[model samples]
Target: MTINETLIEKKFSNDLTEAELLEFKKLYETDDAFKQEVDFLKNVQRVSETEDDALFRNQLATYETEISPKKVFLNSKWIKPFSAIAAIFIITISISLFMNKDINNDSLFSSYFEPSKNVSAPIVRSEKDEHLTNRAFIAYSEADYQQATSLFQKAFEQTGNSELLLYEGNALLAMDKVTEAIEVFKTHLTYSDALTNRTHWYLALAYVKSDQLDKAKQELTIYIDSEEKFKKTEAKSLLKKLK
Candidate 1:
């Protein structure tokens, strides 16, 4: 099956191999045709599920006001029938909520995306061989992402140091190369045990940039639950936005 066709199934099933995942990243970053295909499929799926987004939201608001907050006295005879009716009402509204196209996770991505904080800025690099690393950090701090991305990658290749990898990912992000940043973090997390919570924060932001709502949600879940979560407050706030 074509990647686009597989993407539709994967969206629901949440079962993408690493290579297919990379294809999504590539398409999202580089391919206008593929991007449109994904968007069209998303809209089609949403439209298939919901006729009107505003109406869907309104109905849910109504149901929430009527159903969830009340103390239902189920033991009383009149209340029992009312409860049964309410249950049916809830099931119907729940279906509507899921199917609505306008009820999307991407609406808040822009509002929630601030640059993930620089946690490694305080360290001093002081080696002759580490001149590129120092320059990369300087360029990164100055927001010269083009230079930083190149320098950081060079340092990473020379040393296999996780710090360079992390900073390179950050540079990729500053350059708006988010999918590449995500891949860098994915590899770093898999291979290096050094960068932890902060790396996850960057990964989640990369997912947010890619508009991969579910993937972002997963990483945010890790952040929210982690005691050492570098972006705990941000993750909590972003989760609220996503939901």
Candidate 2:
């Protein structure tokens, strides 16, 4: 298969090798046709898994019957097989419908809001692990966001470690406390820590979750313009959607 078809298949299966992931990112960034095709496929996959799958399947059958025998070209580099033409036609229609609909901030936030891992304080399982910071991160790793948020606040207050605020913000965001997470991320930004860029990215997601489109756009722009590489591509995509 061509890079376009190979990457698209691997993407849906969550099985992209590191090199394939790099190729996917490059194509997604540089090739508009490839990017749109991947996005349309994403919509197709999403709709197929929803409660209206039966209805969507019936519609797909109708679309298939109506599609011409002409081959569907995904990009200059990739022409879909004849058997896949009907599926490609349905994907194109789905993309058109999605484009014509209003931007769903909630859906966008859900799609992109993955909490960063606990990099500030890596937890090791040990009987001697008695430190408050260790317990805080341990709680975080266990998905106990409530306790983790509380311990993070205390740890930051006790140690004056601003990075704890970043984790705290993440815990809050994971718990769906957007306003609290935004404040914690802002507080983290006030410090001259290396995590300043990361905090801003989280703050952007918090703004998006709260439907503060203006703030979300501003924060996303900052992340996209920054030297930080984390989520820069996703930030650009989200910013484009907001626009």
Candidate 3:
């Protein structure tokens, strides 16, 4: 379509060179309308392209939210960190799983695991899409975890809000930043019981992603016993796999 859209597609597709990435960032920094257009495209492309991104994005907001420019700029603070997240790959393992009785954890994890898609319920405070909260929801719904995390954090900062903290954590987990996600969820748990069951289920999945099987099983046990029917079937299946 447009030159900006082409550049953004290249950036997300990991086809941009060092020089192009730098120049693109320059455009991103100076052009607000361009940024929003690019974000809207990203929302469309990411969701329509894969079940993985769509599932994760849905996990960000339990309800619908909108996007805007100022909030998008607040989110731009995280674009650099996303370079790291995008660079990640499951490195090819040379070890033999059957012969040596050892398998690559990455391969093992990939075989049966996907991030839990559960999301915190939307607390529709303020006017619809008024500020950081709605922007954060929009980012997450678009699978823009990098921006979503930043917006969620900024939202939390504005009000000392714990529910936004839950969103930040969920966004991180979706990004596969498991360790950081764990702490955020734990903090949210301490501050509020609003989404206790959802938190437990997601926390358990975080442990699974991080290879903390024992801890995951423990959390899953708590979730299962708590009668959180929302994910009981999925939880039982995952728990059985863990055992």
Candidate 4:
């Protein structure tokens, strides 16, 4: 059926089947002009359906008496001026109301209007021992591996904390500096106590990155035997993958 006929039938009919609605949706997707005409008809039908009968009858009478072709002010020069005056009055009232709104300077509204401050928590530089560790973590989170490595190096100079060394090693690994990462991890292992299960796993990963499969397997063995069940499980999986 033609688009116009389909739209008229949908508008006047009370009970369109599901199939007819689907067909109308398909037509709307494929034809923009058909969709516009359908939308206009739907809006007209909605206004007629919701209009108060008394108000509509009064409006019809007014239209016949004062707005008919013979009686209407079609050529009056004052019509444009009256419309312009009405528009200006509406705009002025809108601006006045908008400007006179009760602004709460002391409330949360002031926070939105004020410029934001850089109130981020200061970088935790508590001690020489923790300074590099904290800075490395911040740099890693910010995806600044080079800065993290430099900070990690400075931290290691003052306090050779295995954890800080591991951070440096991990940063090197992230930068694809595998040989440097391997050296850092190995240095940590030389001084690290037997309780350092996490370090062993990370060292194993560094070894894998360096293509030292045998060393990676040996480190994974130490990691898998540790009491930390989670790290041991992860190490076992890596060992299986290496094999």
Following a full C-alpha superposition, what root-mean-square deviation does model 4 have from the true structure?
A: 23.4
89-118, model 1: which lDDT tens digit per residue?
Answer: 678888888645333534454555555444
TM-scores of the candidates in the order shown: 0.51, 0.57, 0.51, 0.44
Go through the candidates in order and give the clash count of each. 0, 0, 0, 0
lDDT of 4 by residue, 1-243 (tens): 555565446544644568777777787788888778667656554544443445534444455457565644312222333334344566799988655542221121222111111122246645554555567667766768899889878877876665567667777876768789778877877775543556677777766655577888998898787775645655776688668
Q: Name the regions of candidate 2 deviating beyond 4 angstroms.
A: 1-103
lDDT of 2 by residue, 149-212 (tens): 9998888889999889988999999998989999989988889787889887889888888878
Better of 2 and 4 by lDDT: 2
Q: Native-vs-model 4 lDDT?
A: 0.60
Off by over 4 Å in 3: 1-94, 98-130
Error of 1 at 111 (Å): 3.6
lDDT of each: 0.67, 0.79, 0.66, 0.60
- lDDT per residue as tens, model 3, 1-243: 567766776776677989889888899889998788667656644434433343433433222224433333212222433322332211112233333333333444445444434254453445555677777777777788999899889888997767677678878877878899999888877875556666777787777667787998998898899956967887888889778
lDDT of 3 at 60: 31
Best by TM-score: 2
Q: Against the true structure, whose lDDT is highest?
A: 2
TM-score-superior candidate, 2 or 3: 2
RMSD of each: 22.1, 18.5, 24.8, 23.4
Candidate 3 clash pair list: none
Alpha carbon lDDT of residue 188, candidate 3?
A: 77
